[model samples]
Target: MQKFGNATIEILKDETLSKNWYHLRNITYNYTNSKGETKTLKREAYDRGNGATILLYDPKIDSVILVRQFRVPTYVNGYHGWLLETPAGLLDGDNPADAIAREVMEETGYKLRDTRFLFKSFMSPGSVTEVLHFFAAIVDATDRVEEGGGAAHEDEDIEVVVIPLADAMKMIEDGDICDGKTIMLLQWAALNRASLTQ
Candidate 1:
């Protein structure tokens, strides 16, 4: 085992499990507790890289723009229908802001008037190394420059949906909007709608 003096955790082994699309690795590490005890642990982590998501809110209309698309993971987990969610995409090699701007244009066809950084979070910290940067943008009809169906090469068949903010909240209550990042963004919008409009 390699030494990591004064560090709480030390990576002992990081072996690639798969890299077909993203990356999966089986990692072994040594964890040192506060009590001066040490234990070895092994865990598999799926690293699809970090991502970004945004809530497109139009204050003039008191509405938000969203998308519906199929997710194979959700489908295999028993959710047969498409998922309603905020526009999001992997950062790829771009920074959070740049990546989200590209994603919003590709997914919603909205050239945002401005974007406000809300926060960031790990959608599935236990297993997936995907830190999602959340943002909110104010947009209007003029921002729509295209059909906004998603990138063709990614095989994304997305349907754009525009609805009142109230209806979106109700969708959460009725269990229709179940995506984690989308739910978080919606809640943030609901909590800050007034300030956002101003």
Candidate 2:
């Protein structure tokens, strides 16, 4: 690949701010705009690697499975700590499909099969270096092998929630399901219900 346009980027300094679970880097760079104006900027980016998320929909019953758990960031932002969201997790070196399968089983107790790739998105492109791969899988009663409440060792306390697809949409309008990835997947499901049901 070749660099496009007349803009140029130069890194001035790179500093590691934190490296607990993931890594946080403070970077200073000089970006020359296409108009030949150069600006030096400093920004901190949190690199949690990339992750995958999946929406488990049972088209036969017009229902979807989601999970609720406490999110510290949300809690500190003035909202309730618990959020209803689709099953998702860090890739942890696994492929997106494999990671989603493992996370789904761990969070919702369902073995996912035939996961259809939907799309990829940068949930927070400004400060987080995370590209989330999205997928959807059809599942039914037979797939539930255990009562999943997230991984005990990981301190994940998740509550499984199953509701009609219509109701899930209502929750979105009612400000109940406010998670970005969950909302995006639900909208996709609504737009592709007929084909997805088949």
Candidate 3:
């Protein structure tokens, strides 16, 4: 099978949408299909920042740690005001694991040690340039969860929630979780929970 010629995108100009969380960039791309003729596509991509989601597991407790928060977009759309989600954070300038580990501790007060990458995926294959690298983390559940352990400085108002694995799965099935990263990571953990522990 013949493949398209190498495609490249050049940043002509980038406009920041949100301070650090989101950005809209104007770019020019050159793609040559089966024909050698060069085609240019000038388009805008949303730079939502690369991010990560951590599915924290505790074998002894038979549960996972999640977080509850209010999302502005959901509120505006009249969706569930409060959302059940996993520990996720944007990879500002750090690696996915480092970002997620810090997020876990900051949001849930669980200092995780061994974090193994499950996989990485494009958040929206259509237009968004954002990606989500996911991981499964193991942490002991003995630590007390202080309320509102969010990164207040960064405007994160997070509430930690501990759920039995079964309950978490139920919520997912009931259409409670809308975050893509959270859903993928939790589904991954649910399918591989036994192997994940041992």
The predicted structure with the larger lDDT, 2 or 3, is: 2
Whole-model Cα lDDT per candidate? Answer: 0.91, 0.93, 0.77
Give each model a TM-score: 0.94, 0.96, 0.83
Instruction: Give per-residue CA lDDT, model 1, range 165-193, as digits (tens).
Output: 99999999998999989889889888888
TM-score of model 2 (CA atoms): 0.96
Please report how far candidate 2 places residue 181 from its true position, in Å: 0.3
Candidate 2 lDDT (Cα, whole model)?
Answer: 0.93
Q: Judging by TM-score against the true structure, name the best candidate.
A: 2
Rank order by TM-score, top first?
Answer: 2, 1, 3
Error of 3 at 140 (Å): 2.7
lDDT of 1: 0.91
Of candidate 2, the 10-residue stretch with the lowest lDDT total is: 1-10
**Per-residue lDDT over 114-164 for candidate 3, one digit per residue giving the tens place of the 0 to 100 score:** 889888998786778878888897777665454446888988788888888
Q: Encode model 2's per-residue lDDT on 11-104: one tens digit a residue.
A: 8999999999889999998888899898999999999999999989997789999999999999999998899999999999999999999999
Q: Once model 2 is optimally superposed onto the true structure by TM-score, how far is the C-alpha of residue 108 displaced, in angstroms? A: 0.7
Error of 3 at 167 (Å): 1.6
The reply for model 3, stretches above 4 Å from the true place, is 1-21, 35-39, 143-148
